[model samples]
Target: MDFEKLLVWQRAKALTVSVYKEMAACPDLVFKSQITRSALSIPSNIAEGMERFTARDKCRFLRIAKASCGELRTQLMIGSEIAYVAEPLAAVWIIETRELSKMLNGLINRISD
Candidate 1:
């Protein structure tokens, strides 16, 4: 199966792009870098896991991706609360992250079974 064709991966790629754009002008370099990396991790982990030869390895990476989703959600919330991220954008991102997490859970279960 090709990871690129995955809906979750596609959404993750979009999320990563959105995050990069959102943080392009952020004065807090550290925050911007961290969030973007977390955003990037979603799709990267998905692809890496999909490419793996074993179910165990795939699940491991998927779990990592799911964890990264939690990290990203927290960062986005903090960014929104601090007014660093616009409310509307943050809202969409938060929704997307949650959805991605759900999708990842489903994928992980499907793979493990």
Candidate 2:
């Protein structure tokens, strides 16, 4: 399957773009970088995983991408708590992250099956 055609990849890419735009004006460089990097990892890992020849390798990549999603969610939560990102925006991101995680889980299951 084409990586771009995957809904999860599309969502991850959109979320990454959103994170970049929202974090653009953040005064805290470290927090901004942390959030953006993890956000970027989701789609990148997904793409890399899809390129793998074996199901095990693909699942491994998806797992890594899912881990990155968790990392991004944690960063966003911290950002919200610390006021780097507003609660509403963080909430949206959190939900988006959750959805992406679910999609990853489903894909992993399909691959395993």
Candidate 3:
């Protein structure tokens, strides 16, 4: 199964792009760097996991991606509170992170079984 064929991977890739674009002009270098890294980790991990030879390896990377979703969500929240991110955009990204997390969970369970 190619990671590109997965809807979750597609969504995560899109979200990462959005995050990069949104943070491109951010004045807070530290926050922007951290948030963007978290965003990038999601799809990256998914792709890596899907390419793994074993189910255990796949699950490990998927779990990392899921955790990255949570990390991204937290960063988004902080970005919104600190005015680094617009409230509406942050809300949307946060929702995406939650959905991505759930999707990763489902994928993990399916792979585990």
Q: Candidate 2 on 1-113: residue-level lDDT in tens? A: 99999999999999999999999999999888888999999999999999999999999999999999899999989999999999999999999999999999999999979
Error of 1 at 12 (Å): 0.4
Q: Which 10-residue window of candidate 2 scores lowest in summed lDDT?
A: 27-36
RMSD of each: 0.6, 0.6, 0.4
The worst-scoring run of ten residues by lDDT in candidate 1 lies at 14-23
Clashes of 2: 0
Ranking by lDDT: 3, 1, 2
**lDDT (0 to 1) per candidate:** 0.96, 0.95, 0.97
Please estimate how well model 3 matches the true structure, expressed as its whole-model Cα lDDT.
0.97
Q: What TM-score would you give candidate 3 relative to the actual structure?
A: 0.99
Model 1 residue 90 CA deviation in Å: 0.6
Task: Specify the highest-TM-score model's number.
Answer: 3
